[model samples]
Target: MTKDLYARHRSVLPDWLALYYEDPLEITHGEGRHVWDSAGNKYLDFFGGILTTMTAHALPEVTKAVSEQAGRIIHSSTLYLNRPMVELAERIAHVSGIPDARVFFTTSGTEANDTALLLATAHRRSNTILAMRNSYHGRSFSSVGITGNRGWSPTSLSPLQTLYVHGGVRTRGPYAHLDDRDFIDACVADLLDLLGHTRPPAALIAEPVQGVGGFTSPPDGLYAAFREVLHERGILWIADEVQTGWGRTGDHFWGWQAHGRSGPPDIVTFAKGIGNGMSVGGVIARAEIMNCLDANSISTFGGTQVTMAAGLANLNHLLEHDLQGNARRVGGLLIERLRAVAAQVPHVREVRGRGLMIGVELTRPGTDEAAPEVASAVLEEARAGGLLVGKGGGHSTSVLRIAPPMSLTVAEAEEGAAILERALRSI
Candidate 1:
């Protein structure tokens, strides 16, 4: 049955749409932290559908909200007043930290980011944009234009004139050998040099933690320093928080808070977990930027009642239970455990990340060469051992990405870590 389905999927889906493992598993059902694939195999879900499942599988509050909203009204175009949408927007605006914030909903992170780009360009009257090297915004044409990772970015014909910046990855680059303070200074100097060569950009867009770039990040306050420069030139700072938002980073509610010395970003884009599996994405910006468009614009399905209901419920659950705190505690222990395990593995290059968004980079034993094959082997072995994880890196997917739900338990973390240890050993 699985083989037949696989054949059908390959025939129907685009070849570029990648799947996991030697044999991809079709997950049929889930509960809490576990999911069942076809043929009745159960695995502990670590990746959470690319970290979209924030709280848990089949969370009762979100389920109830969705079901109730669907029964009442699933969708209505932006022509009418949407109570759920308004409520969710109000909550988001309050938490966004931007003064006089305005929220615009979309269907995915790509759309949210595209909207942000539109606002920034229109408001600042420039198509030039600055993005960090190894950063990924989304997959849409506009979003892809700003992406700096070569593997994910397919073309150079972009609507925006994009300049790739430094300091997204601190492990391997021209300044990797420098200490944290020196590295920050070098990146700042490089930014100043880059700014001299180009027209003033509309915005400098970045992810607080580069998600698809193997969860890599610069030292704390790097962005704050960059913000100072950008602010001086009246350039907008946009934080792409698709994977790092909603307390997944543990210590902060938003990933941008790590660089809080510069205050809030001019714009913030978020998706992936806000609706707890419902398709909800949005951008938050101050009124001056958000209201820059002369003509009206709307997303037909953006703020549908059902998705808004789910978003509201999910946000309530996250805050009520303090899932962010849970992420910090459990994720802290999980990373420590994995670090211990990685120390014994020959190919493990580095272990890094905050809260549940951890990464284990693989390299050739005793060498700096990226070992993508070793990462793949570890992924397959971990699946066989009843664990599911993810892989991503600028160096051909050479890093193991471990992002469990924010509601992860300590025991579950221990279990996942043990399975990962065995998988690393097998590799």
Candidate 2:
């Protein structure tokens, strides 16, 4: 029956959809950081389901909240008030430390980002958006329009007014090997030039850490300086924290906080960890930016009750357990171990990133080209040794990204890194 179902679905699904299964493992259930295949084989989750399960799978509190809320209500219209929705928004605003943040929830990160992109344009009445090269924002037309990668858009480029690229180098910092001051100056100059060439920019969108762009970390004070430029030009700084936020980075509650900005972003997007594994996403914009909203901007089923319940429970779990601190301590240990492993393995080119959101880059001998195949081999070997990993790179599949749940223990991280080292050795 399962095989028949898969065959029927494959017949109708688009080729470009990129289904993961040639002979897919039918996953039936998950708990904590472990998932069980239909055959009962369990996999220790290191990738955290693409960094979405911050609290791990089937969290007790989160599940209870969902079950309880399901009995009372599942969804409601935006025209009416719901308790969970109100509470979740309030919690997010308080934790974010963004004064007077007005949130609009959506069912997925892409939709949340879609609203943010439109909000930026509406508030500034401008079309040009400054973005980073190799950044992955979302898959929607406008979100993909601002994103710098061809992979996100198989379709032709959208005719937006302006698109600028920055930061695609091997060295540390946003612009690769540039000091914070020089990188900030160059990026600011680029933004000014783009603004002068086109009309004023609607927004300057960026991730706190570039997730899909090989886990790029911006230069320190980069966002602050860029924010100043955008503020001067009456443009919004849209911090796309889809992958970097929700305490996955470890040190900060949100990715923007790690950047050391004096004021929060004019707009910020959150998903993934917002509701554990549920499809809940949202944009938190300042009251000033949200003032631009009109009748047409509202979503029909964005902030449903079920999503709010899940979000609230996830936030509670994060706070009660102090998962952010765990992320910091455990992730630090993991990074140090990964660096040590890199030193031992010639193929492991570099180990970088903050807290739990770490990456080990690989490259072949004599060539600057990334050895993504080597990275893939490492992944397979790690899986053989009982671990799962995610891959990323611009040149090759050079990056082995380690974005485990905040719930991952220090001992678990050590075990995972040890397995990784063993895998590299086997290769």
State the C-alpha lDDT per candidate: 0.95, 0.78
| Residue 10, model 1: Cα distance from true site in angstroms | 1.2
* Predicted structure 2: clash tally: 1
List where candidate 2 sits over 4 angstroms from the true fold: 1-9, 19-23, 168-175
User: What TM-score, computed on C-alpha atoms, does each candidate reach?
Assistant: 0.99, 0.93
Q: Which ten residues in a row have the lowest lDDT in candidate 2?
A: 18-27
Write the residue-wise lDDT of candidate 1 on 1-427 in tens digits.
Answer: 9889999999999999999988989999999999999999999999999999989999999999999999999998889999999999999999889999999999999999999999999999999999999999999988899999988988888999999999999999999999999999999999999999999999999999999999999999999999999999999999999999999999999999999898999999999999889999999999999999999777899999999999999999999999999999999999999999989999999999999999999999998899989999999999999999999998679999999889999999999999999999997
Question: Which residue pairs show collisions in model 2?
Answer: 372-397
Backbone clashes under 3 angstroms, per model: 0, 1
Instruction: Please give the RMSD to the true structure for each candidate, in Å.
Output: 0.6, 2.3
Output the lDDT of residue 382, model 2. Answer: 76
- Model 2 — TM-score against the truth? 0.93
Worst 10 residues of 1 by lDDT: 148-157
